[model samples]
Target: MAVDLENPSNYLTTRVRQAVNWGRKYSLWPLPFGVACCAIEFMSTVSSYNDISRFGAELVRFSPRQSDLMIIAGTISYKQAPILKTIYAQMAEPRWVIAMGACASSGGFYNNYSTLQGADRVIPVDMYVAGCPPTPENLLYALTQIQERVEREGLVPAAVRHAGRVQV
Candidate 1:
């Protein structure tokens, strides 16, 4: 016997997942970790003109414990790397890291011996915003991308720990 019945339950489940994803995409709280020049642009994104609040991410918390997304917005020097790592450590599970601006992405112009060369070397970056100092609009775009990434991952609640010396 051959059965030709369509499964309506499968379709409903798919639609439900899509709707949930859409909602989460619009509500991202980005914790701006601005250190230097590019930080200026990071500030602009949260202001009225760019109005990052429209996307529901205006609650930029300075405390890592209260934030889930970390936006590294400037040059990260060697001295700052440990601090950045500490903050990343403080964030809860399922956190995301966005490297904003060329400086944070690849050390930009300060390719001297002090800069970290890239924030990724210190913390795991989920998105990278290009430009010596990206505009607020660009930052918003990156935020959208971060949202997309979150959706694609299905917002799975889990911790992503970087490999390091094991405490024995």
Candidate 2:
């Protein structure tokens, strides 16, 4: 192949930072914190039927220490809030969180004091999927939204930007 000095198309910027971000966007290691009925739907989203792997998020990491993406799938009682916060703190940097259903987003129907109004109160959420127990499709859509956001934002830490803005 003849080299063209003036050609922009011949170059693919492979800077170390951008290269890492590219991998992070595609190979999101999800740590599912499934708690209730929504957990069931989360399962379907990862199953062979829906195949979340198509988005490069197939490997589900049970250990928060090893994962970058956290999906909170159900209600969080007041007593559990602290625990959730601890777990969030344990996860490595460049982590992103997905509040996967109405319950995780806003405590669903548990409007009482025992249930935290939202998981966001404890940890910042990068995406929210609406539904009592959102459909697998909705969850998939949420994943795509997260991917797009990641693409736009690169390796920006969700905690730094949204730490003070986790109102939802």
Query: Highest TM-score: which candidate?
Result: 2
Model 2 clashing residue pairs (backbone): none
Off by over 4 Å in 1: 1-16, 157-168
* lDDT (Cα, tens digit) per residue for candidate 1, span 1-168: 654468655433357777887777776677778898778998888888999988778988998888888999889999998899888888886778889998899888888999888888867777889988898889889888878877776575434343352111
TM-score of each: 0.82, 0.86
RMSD of each: 6.8, 4.3
**Residue range 24-133, candidate 2, lDDT tens digits:** 78989999999889899989999999999999999999999999899998899998888888888889988889998988998888899799998988789878899989
lDDT values, one for every candidate: 0.80, 0.87
Q: How many backbone clashes does candidate 1 have?
A: 0
Which stretch of 10 consecutive residues in model 1 shows the poorest summed lDDT?
Answer: 159-168
For candidate 1, the lDDT comes to 0.80
Q: How badly does each model clash, as a count of residue pairs?
A: 0, 0
